[model samples]
Target: MGSNIVFSANNNEEVMVLPVVPEIEVNKPQNNEQFETLNNGTINLIGDEGLRTFSIASIFPSQKYSWLKHGSVAEPFKYVDFFNKWRAKKVPLRVVTSRPDGREWFNMPCVIDSFTFKQLRNGDIEYTLDMAEYRFIGGV
Candidate 1:
């Protein structure tokens, strides 16, 4: 008996490769029409009806008192003095401004010092308003 060996040299095998995934395409608004269409659906009413809802306004007096805070280091005192003036006039005081991205100096502990939780509640506000114009008053 002789040993038998088998060998194949013409064998062909195909290697498969996966296709690449396409990048995401974001369709940004090109004009006001496209912009308004996306935003209009979210709005319900306009004019007086919208105005009837809770309204918040920011007032910059012509002259800030000497006791008021001027720079960022003393901004908290400005908020405090504003509320104090409102209290003196017997008017409710509420604060509404753009939502802060992170821990702002105005939102720090030292800035809100002495104001109790309940008193702080009176300074609550709904949403920040988008003002078309703003004015800062200098010396009294």
Candidate 2:
């Protein structure tokens, strides 16, 4: 079974591994339904399924440090630029998640719906990413 979870983003040629592991929350697609009463007391249903959403919360240190996975140092200030670029580009990213039971979930062609940053009293920074699966009209 896999133990640790890793997150990586492809800004260009380099795939930066997020230093900290965040809690991933996945909400499955919900069914949308509406019922119309008939004269016989039976109901007719009409509706479709909704889209899924994902949210991740983690802390990004405001200091330069090396990540053991990539063995590369990352500066906190650079993350601001990264997030800004990703938000502005409106491109789909591949997000891979590994579970503890040797199971991996891959979410591709996803875009960042929202990105938020907060500063704590301890001088630490926290980032929350809200994403949604992108369904292409043609194909991804």
Q: Against the true structure, whose TM-score is highest?
A: 2
How many residue pairs collide in each prediction?
Answer: 0, 0
> Largest lDDT belongs to which candidate?
2
Query: Per-residue CA lDDT of candidate 2, range 1-140, in tens?
Result: 44233434553443445656566777877575556566656554545655678987876665554532243234554555666676677666656666657577664556788889877776556788888877778653
- What would the per-residue lDDT of candidate 1 be over residues 47-136, giving only the tens digit for each residue? 221111121222222343353222212233343354444345543222222212422111100011123212223332212112111112
Per-residue lDDT of 100 in model 2: 56
Candidate 2 stretches greater than 4 Å from native = 1-14, 39-49, 63-73, 119-123
Candidate 2 overall lDDT versus native: 0.62
TM-scores across all candidates? 0.19, 0.71
Candidate 1 is scored at a TM of: 0.19
